[model samples]
Target: MNVTICVGSSCHLKGSPKVIKRLEYLIAQHHLEDQIELSGSFCMDQCSLGSSGVCVQVDHVVHSVTPSTVDSFFQEYILGGLAS
Candidate 1:
């Protein structure tokens, strides 16, 4: 699966960087670095919703993400798929 994280100006100011790092670490922990393609996006137009925070794209589907729920997002979308 491919994961695209938004770290644009708006997202950076909100805590997107931390989210990215967390995902990176998770990928490493689960040995998903090879299966998961991770990249940074400029923006996803969700910033207007207060911090907009971050966006995560899995398998071509883009989901509006935030720092608060990023862990669940990864567990449910990224790692969950691998387990199943």
Candidate 2:
């Protein structure tokens, strides 16, 4: 899985650094370091759409991700996606 996080100005203020940290920890905790590839990107343009959290792209599909949503987001998107 390729996880792309938005590090643009909007997302940086929204806590992109924490988001990146949490994801990295989760990937390591779950022993998915080999399967998951994490990366960064510029603006995803979701902020203009009024999305609540930072934008994260798993593969190519985009999703809003906040610090609060990190765990669940990891469970459903990363772990769950790997399940199937």
Candidate 3:
């Protein structure tokens, strides 16, 4: 999966930078660099909610996400038992 984080002005202020760093570290630590691709993104038009959140994209499907809920999102969806 490739995780694209919106780093627009709003997102930056909301704390996407920290999320990016945390995810990067996790990817590296888990040796998921090959399984995942993390990148900075422009506004996905969810700026109304601003930076207080994150987003996860698998293939082309995008999910509105937040830092606090990322763990469950990953565990239940990304790394969950369901096959894509």
lDDT of 1 by residue, 1-84 (tens): 778887778778778788899889888998888999889989777667534556667777777667778889898988887778
Model 3 residue 47 lDDT?
A: 70
User: Per-candidate TM vs. native?
Assistant: 0.80, 0.94, 0.72
Model 3 is weakest, by summed lDDT over 10 consecutive residues, at 49-58
> Which one wins by TM-score: 1 or 3?
1
Q: Enumerate residue pairs that collide in model 1.
A: none
Tell me the deviation in Å of residue 47 in model 3.
1.7
- Model 2 scores a TM of 0.94
lDDT of 2 by residue, 1-84 (tens): 899999999988888999999999999998999999999999988886426788999987888889999899999999988998
Candidate 2 positional error at 32, Å:
0.7
- Candidate 1 has a TM-score of 0.80
- Which candidate leads the pack in TM-score? 2
Which residue pairs does candidate 2 place in steric collision? Answer: none
After superposing all C-alphas onto the true structure, candidate 3 shows an RMSD in angstroms of 2.7
RMSD of each predicted structure: 2.1, 1.1, 2.7
By TM-score, is 1 or 2 better?
A: 2
